[model samples]
Target: MYILYIFRFFIQKEEGMSCCSFLDLTEADLNLMELNMDRTEFVVQEDGSLISECNDDPNASQRIRVRSDIQERRNTQSMTGTNKVPLHMFSRFGTVRATLLHRVAEGQALVLAANGSFTENNRRALMRILISELIKVHGSCYPPDEAKVALAQAIVTEFPLLRNTRTKKGYEHYYDEETRRGFIEYRLWNVRRTLSPSQKKYKTKALDSGKTTPVSPNINLLSQEELDSKIAWMKCTNPSDSNKQNIATHLQETLQNRRDWIIKKSPNISQILHEYPRLLDYNGEMINNEFRYFFKEKSVNFLARFPSYYCPRILEYAKLNRLDVYNRLKNITDVNLRALFILADLLRINNAMLAQQGDKGKGKMKGKKRQRSSEEAEMIEKEKIDVPSTFLVRFAGTPLPQSIQEASATGSIIIPPYIVCTQEENGRNSYFVQGDGWLIKPRNNNPVTAFDLLFKVYFALKICYPAGLQIFYNFIESYVYDLGTKARGVVTSLHVNLSNLKLDKIASEEFIFGS
Candidate 1:
């Protein structure tokens, strides 16, 4: 009867649906139903008899072996065990990419599900698993170039199809050494594929059609410039009349504000570049006209690719957060530095909130405030923390230019870390400092939402700060992602202390942006 039921189970099983299909284990190896006999450890011997082992009882350790067929039992009962599973097979690693890989390895699936689309979650999971695997094979301290090569090799090994798919106009465009490194870096740094308004609309329409086509063959083929051309072509031929004038106005105002801020912040671009020489490839001898020229050259016709809806949304976030400096000063030209500043400010804000929260308990019985007992007062004092004057603000979200990372590491780049005062456990205050490391990309073409960047910076700072010390965070306002339809607030942390602090083993490997 058990064998009959097992055959029925296989008949009912969906093709390419099971995650465990990747493993080479057969029905004989995994007899799930047979585990009902006992909850303790048991070993199967050459004669297929189960031998129980119990440290508590010497007699139980050598108990008579049961001659029951374990494979037959699997059909009737579920297997239960206390041993921890490998991290790769763990529930936490059960992401879309992992699932797809598992399915493919089982030889039941060849591509992503027809109805599935490439998503940020899939990108993040791929980056995470690949990074961890690479770190395991190569040391965590592998150089950036070497790491990319290792990652590419791993990719081809895990997904053999990726190797054969490499062609000039094929889906896999990273077969070349230079392009492969860039592609790997893009994934490692969490850079996303940027789409124009029309492209996004088309994608949404496709998804709404109730049929998810297989992953697009040309999904990652287009660059930002090519997308910009598409947007321009669409605008000239089929301009969107839905809030078109408003979007254009918003874009103009935003660009003007950024330009004004650049002038205000640094009247002479050369002087500012001189102060931060690492930001520039050449010496600061370039004139303002030359700087502007270079900026124009790099920007070209790429600005049109931005989703018109994104402009108004980002603007609203800027106003709500009172980020005049960021909104006014930042543009495609200095996006990298802008991202760094944004991250730094997020850390600073979190610190201030933490400090403020800590101050609440220190009031001296003024008005309706009650005086705390000696014990409570001592506890409060213990919670009060001194903010660090300066500390390292490491970039572990996305890889930056090698020169910039080197400068940040050597203390040549002066990013003053912020501080806050609060008493909170690591788990409680973790959100303010937890990010998946997909914050900013090298180009402004694929700008991240303020909501997204805030968390990235929070995680980056979380990587730098110690958890034993109390931390705090606050979000006065939130940024809307879907044109005000959905909003997300910034997550800030409590404090920073660059003292004689020692990071726990876990903390040391938490952030790996440019490592």
Candidate 2:
């Protein structure tokens, strides 16, 4: 009788009919069905039948189902469509649900109850598994908003009790559209945050944007032989009064060629120093000359306006705003240190304002929360200024180190065109310009001159301004150098600061002249 029943079950399965149609399945038979279902290995066919390898079947094919009726019901639902989740894709979730149901049927303890409600820990675990499977298909933790919504819909459809009816949509708790805050978005944010800098995809601004390109070299002016000879001479000759004039003249004649080499060829600082060794001259005369050649009249404006116009106005602005560093600024007598402090503070303030504005603009466009919460404001406030482009270091009767590595070892990265200020025995500050692997000591001991050299080198060498000091350099370019013509359309934090400075200047003038 047992053999006849087993043969009849095989005949029913072979005819694409459930064995339960012929005989009643006990709890042991249901448990056996659950244990035999290889959810991971099964593949759905074009006809919507889930098939897996069967060792006992003569055809080597077996139609598997979660239960006797699930396959028939799933097959009746149309699976062919764009943006439709495949039925087989939910097998893992179904398998997990079946296991939980089986445990509950057996009166075993579980985090998930038979009614589909689960503990917070179990819910998180399910979400993590779903997200992992989604990432496998989407190939990124940051899946499209649509895919996230679809997943949320699937979850709510499967478990009606988990659906949130409070919001406009039932799945908003899983993935909110307005604030872009919810379980999925929060998890994705964490995933992206944990990725290394190299793994993250970021949009970077072009190096030449909003800045003038260096003039192309006058290649026809000097023959290759003449250029080579001049470069060789500059490389070999030492800086002396008699040869200094010739070096300057040769440098002028070969100026375009040198600029071409630096700009077009884009050689590193070490290569530049190797090609034209005079760049490392103790007095930095050639460096200044090259800067003057590029900027011409604007070369002198930085020194002229910095102390008289910029410093006083900046200090006054800090005072009026009642900034934290105002008292510290008043106590610092060293003009160089005072200037560094101001630039650092300005950088921090500018970045914070920009971040706040960016967040506000995004919120407004998305029709989400417009006002920045205190947490957001605090995040902006906590932003640190970029490592100082120019800084001061005091030594106890020791000469400051010259190499980029030694000099920048304390806190900075010593990208070329960086400035280091040290106090001399004569109570004057000496500025050293760090190159790729070398340093240039300017003849002047003025902080303004140091800043001038720093800005000029960026243009002269065709190097991009350091990221931390971009706003500070932009202020110099737009205000000090009066090169705002190209950048007027783009209103930046620096522009706003400049506008405020102008307003303050006008207000002070009005008060002085009794307007």
Candidate 3:
């Protein structure tokens, strides 16, 4: 009987959210359902308390069903301007508070009769009823920010089962403070659900006409465009690259072998090495007419080492757009070395842009901006390209210089500040060793000064350490690409040699580089 009472109480209130008439369920109706009593089984005294006169009835239970009509009448009277207000009203907060208090009473009554855990459906119904009441009392712009924490508290108080548990021994941390806070925030988040324009119009039309009409059976709640967008967000359109996965299988085809071949006989590599530094500035004409092949080949080689470094689609994207490699790497004057780096960076930005666009369709972000016009909306719809879902590539790029490759391959599994012996010689190599690491320089026309050389050597020691060139490259990628434009600028401006900079010292300070 108690279980039936709890079930009916929640379902009837939940129905009120969709059809307001259910809010008028009389006390007599509740008594009939909860106590399973006929009209003769119980009587309501003048004070409105339930009583059973028949002593023959072995099971006697007293239940108090408060008048829902009181609150309904008060709400109606307020809407009709029958109640005068003071100089300052408490505003929306008062409504949320009152709704919470009412739910607490209802929840307490159910909890008293509830001996076991709540069913999932009943719990969901109760939450929906609470949310609907809050929304109703507070208007369309509901769940005012200030009341969310209090609301969560009310929920936990009413449904103690939702509370996080802590054992006496403290062996298990089932729901820590942070996680519980996240739970509260999740409940307070703005609810999103699908609603078709036709369905909404139907409801409004029925209300206005004061009559019901049969709805069209052919209406699609989810349009084809919306469905496709959702699918794109959830599934990757591009298939896995079988050729790229052959890297591990063909381990003998090392980058060292390729680099050696290029240096000895590849005329293209020879020509690029001579022209790269002198190519100096980015000239679109020069890139188009003379250097396009050089950039493509070098980029291919660089990309080979990390087989999965970029999506194959990125290359296709570049080809379709005719992205000027030299123009993009205008900041890195050592064009031969940084062309691939620039390409990788640009691809990352493009990927982020695609992800951002897809998020709008998912409605993951919230905004209060005015709606766009039909023409503007049409233009935006036309402009949105279907983005392929993707995962991080797992292939290595082209091989490094033999010495760099050997060093990198040795410490590949190590965390940063990865160090390796510069050469096979054990006796000659020492931690104090210098004059062997690579220098990272900005693209500029100025002559290489003594300070520049010193700066290069200094930063090399800080990054290279016993000497792993890959570590230096890794630092460049993470510090530059991972940072925003502003933070990247800060990194570029720190032109001073960092050879003596310690990893520990850097970690000790809080660098406000990126989120």
Predicted model with the maximum lDDT: 2
**Distance from true location, Cα of 96 in model 3, Å:** 7.3
User: Considering lDDT, where higher is better, how would the candidates rank from best to worst?
Assistant: 2, 1, 3
Candidate 3 lDDT (Cα, whole model)? Answer: 0.30
Best by TM-score: 2
**Stretches of model 1 off by over 4 angstroms after superposition:** 1-99, 103-115, 131-265, 268-515
Off by over 4 Å in 2: 1-221, 328-331, 349-386, 389-414, 425-428, 488-515
RMSD of each: 24.7, 20.0, 24.5
TM-score of decoy 3:
0.22
Ranking by TM-score: 2, 3, 1
As for candidate 2, its clashing pairs are none
Whole-model lDDT values for every prediction: 0.30, 0.52, 0.30
Q: Candidate 1 on 1-515: residue-level lDDT in tens?
A: 12211111221223442322312245454475443323434444455433334446656544433223344233213211233223233112233245345434421232341122222233335545555433333322222454455445544455433332213332222223545433345443332234344433223221121221222344333455653454344334322455444434333323332233333342232333233222221111111123233244332221232123223322233333436646753652323223333433433433333333333433322211122223322322354422211221222343333543454456443222221112246522111111222112222112222223332232212212221122212221111111111111112100101111122232223222211
Counted clashes in each candidate structure: 14, 0, 16
Query: Each candidate's TM vs. the true structure?
Result: 0.21, 0.45, 0.22
lDDT of 3 by residue, 1-515 (tens): 01111111123223323222333446676667564434333333336333434545444344333355534544644533544432222232344235434567765544542223333233444455555644444432223433444454554444444433322311111112333333222332334223444423223221121121222345333445654443343233222344223322221222222223333342232232232321111211212212222233332232232212222222332333335743554453322223234333333333332333332322211221111122222222344421110011011232223433343346431111211212225523211111223222222211121112222222211211111122223333333222111112112211111211112322212221110
Lowest lDDT 10-residue stretch of candidate 1: 492-501
